[model samples]
Target chain A: MPIHYPNGRRFHETNTKKRSPAPKKISYSNRGMTLEEDLNETNRYYLEHGLAVIHKKPTPVQIVSVDYPKRSAAVIKEAYFKQASTTDFNGVYQGKYIDFEAKETKNKTSFPLSNFHDHQVVHMQKVIEQNGISFVILRFTQTEEIYLLDSRFLISYYQNMDTTRKSIRKSDIEKNGHLIKMGFHPRVDYLKIVDSVYFSN
Target chain B: MPIHYPNGRRFHETNTKKRSPAPKKISYSNRGMTLEEDLNETNRYYLEHGLAVIHKKPTPVQIVSVDYPKRSAAVIKEAYFKQASTTDFNGVYQGKYIDFEAKETKNKTSFPLSNFHDHQVVHMQKVIEQNGISFVILRFTQTEEIYLLDSRFLISYYQNMDTTRKSIRKSDIEKNGHLIKMGFHPRVDYLKIVDSVYFSN
Candidate 1:
């Protein structure tokens, strides 16, 4: 026997008598989706819930040419992706300006500093100087763990790179960063961590 | 005699002896550039002076198809411009979230409400509800005058459109909006106006 989905994909049916009585909880972290997709979904949830107004900036592209065919919409025919000058996410949250860059790594032991660009470092520093909350969300895909690392600590490491190691180890993150617990609706409920870390004072 | 520019474009030179003794002041407003270009220049000035950290979000595009030719960059062979979910300019300034949309109208008497979309109105409303600063920068290109109209007033007019007019008259803007004095360094010194209007007690 086979169970067919609405889109017509059939799954081989298993014997009911030999199966365990209890059903197992589904784990979303193993779904093989990118971290970006998860963050987008989480942002959408936050927006609908009136928790935050954050949004990911669109991908920058250098449009070189466009074709306007007769009785049709104009089409971008030739373009190249451009390097972004700012971080991906920014918005207002609880009367404070929030800006952050999200990155995921398969490497379990450390998060490479090379994941960030020099301009992004400068931008984050500027944001901090202006008293806005700036941080990076680091997702360790292997462990399904997320950490919020403040820009002050990130800048210290960036400036002293000549004397220190090139990457921030998992131990350093575990000590300085705040871990974000996974959620059912808003998969990454980062604002909860923001409240405790930034507003606790 | 003709005066030639550095790039070799000849400007018809009226007799040097007949011209005024003192050099005439250059008018930047008559430079024939778009409002977007002026705002970009102003934003650059603000960033350089550490006055603000504002940027225009990149235009959203839906990339439908791409072709990777041999030995060269990937070509975006087919794509369409997507409607932006948020306003154009957004950033943090003086610890407050700043968000705005810029528009220029050739008509000197009024600004057509049709320049805005329903979603933009909703987004601005959300920004206001969260206690963030939100507004519109309306430039009358014919008069070379700029005005900052707060979202609260704009929303009032938008909601009462059935009984009200289709556009905001210049007289109404003159009475309700803050006029931004044009300057040389930052052509539109809008943040100064923001300070006076939003932060002034």
Candidate 2:
């Protein structure tokens, strides 16, 4: 039977289960998690441990058509992805509003400016103006190095891209951003940087 | 050509334009908007005027398969809706974290507890524990009346529902919750209630 939410939207538990397929044989050498997966695990750790209440917003989808069978769950037959109007992750932590975007780049020398969208940058600016904690988590995939850069620096660099360098140099990020150490329990472990940068008096 | 976001997801502006089809002939007397639509417009108004920063989280959808046509946008071929793990609307207001769920009911005597889910109640509890503002906006459609009820009252009522009452009485809501007067510009105008209930220091 189709399970319908209070708002009349149908849900299927099977689809959620199918979202993560069966795990393959473990190989430590080749196995690696994407930045999104790492952040998701970190956020889940925060939530389960009663530390924070952050969550990644679902990818926006412009749903077109739906199929309603007599006895089966409603299936979405047609849809297309939509551009998000704000950052991907946000929540409340220690009486503070937290909002941020995470991105991973393969380039070793610098992070490409094209990784961010104009609307996302503007959204981060608005978040900062509202006195929320706003920043970006950047990971260099090749070096396995991650940094939490303040949105102010990002916005400044993004705005000056035409005049200055097209991409932010690794040295500039190292100077302005805080390096995040990967951990066992919470993989990304970004709250430490947030505490030191935004909360430390 | 299909417009692709930096994350490689395809987007089509036409899809968004299609999401809201051409507005039907205006029926001033009979036209009524859903609570979700009202809140959306209200949030937009707040954002534009820089009064507050809030947004409704996108509906969660589990994508099963996608088809990338040679010269067209990537179409979601198979997908299913998933139950959201938290409240629908959340953001920052005057440097404070804000979170809430909104529901409308036709019940004249009482507000049905069925409108809320267990996870949402728990999420609200977590938000309050983090010192974030949490509440519920409920509408009695029969009388076109709305109230903003604190989540603490809601949680208590929900917990003892089996013994005391299956639903919260309208009289109880009238006494405990703040009545939100509908308005022309923002429609619901629930922020006035938030300011009075939460920030009246």
Best by DockQ: 2
Error of 1 at B82 (Å): 1.0
Q: CA shift at B165, candidate 1, in angstroms?
A: 2.8
Q: Please report, as a residue range, the 10-residue window in candidate 2 chain A with the lowest summed lDDT.
A: A1-10
lDDT of 1 by residue, B68-98 (tens): 5666666667767667789999998988899
Inter-residue clash pairs, candidate 2: none
Writing each residue's lDDT as its tens digit, candidate 1 over A139-168 gives 887789999999898888878776468888
lDDT of 2 by residue, A6-114 (tens): 2222232223322324432222321345577678878988998999999989888888877666566667788877778899999999988999999988789899988
Candidate 1: lDDT over CA atoms? 0.77
Span of ten consecutive residues with least summed lDDT in model 1 chain A? A9-18
Give per-model CA RMSD. Answer: 11.1, 7.8
Complex DockQ per candidate = 0.28, 0.38
Q: What is the lDDT of residue B15 in candidate 1?
A: 16
lDDT of 1 at B184: 68
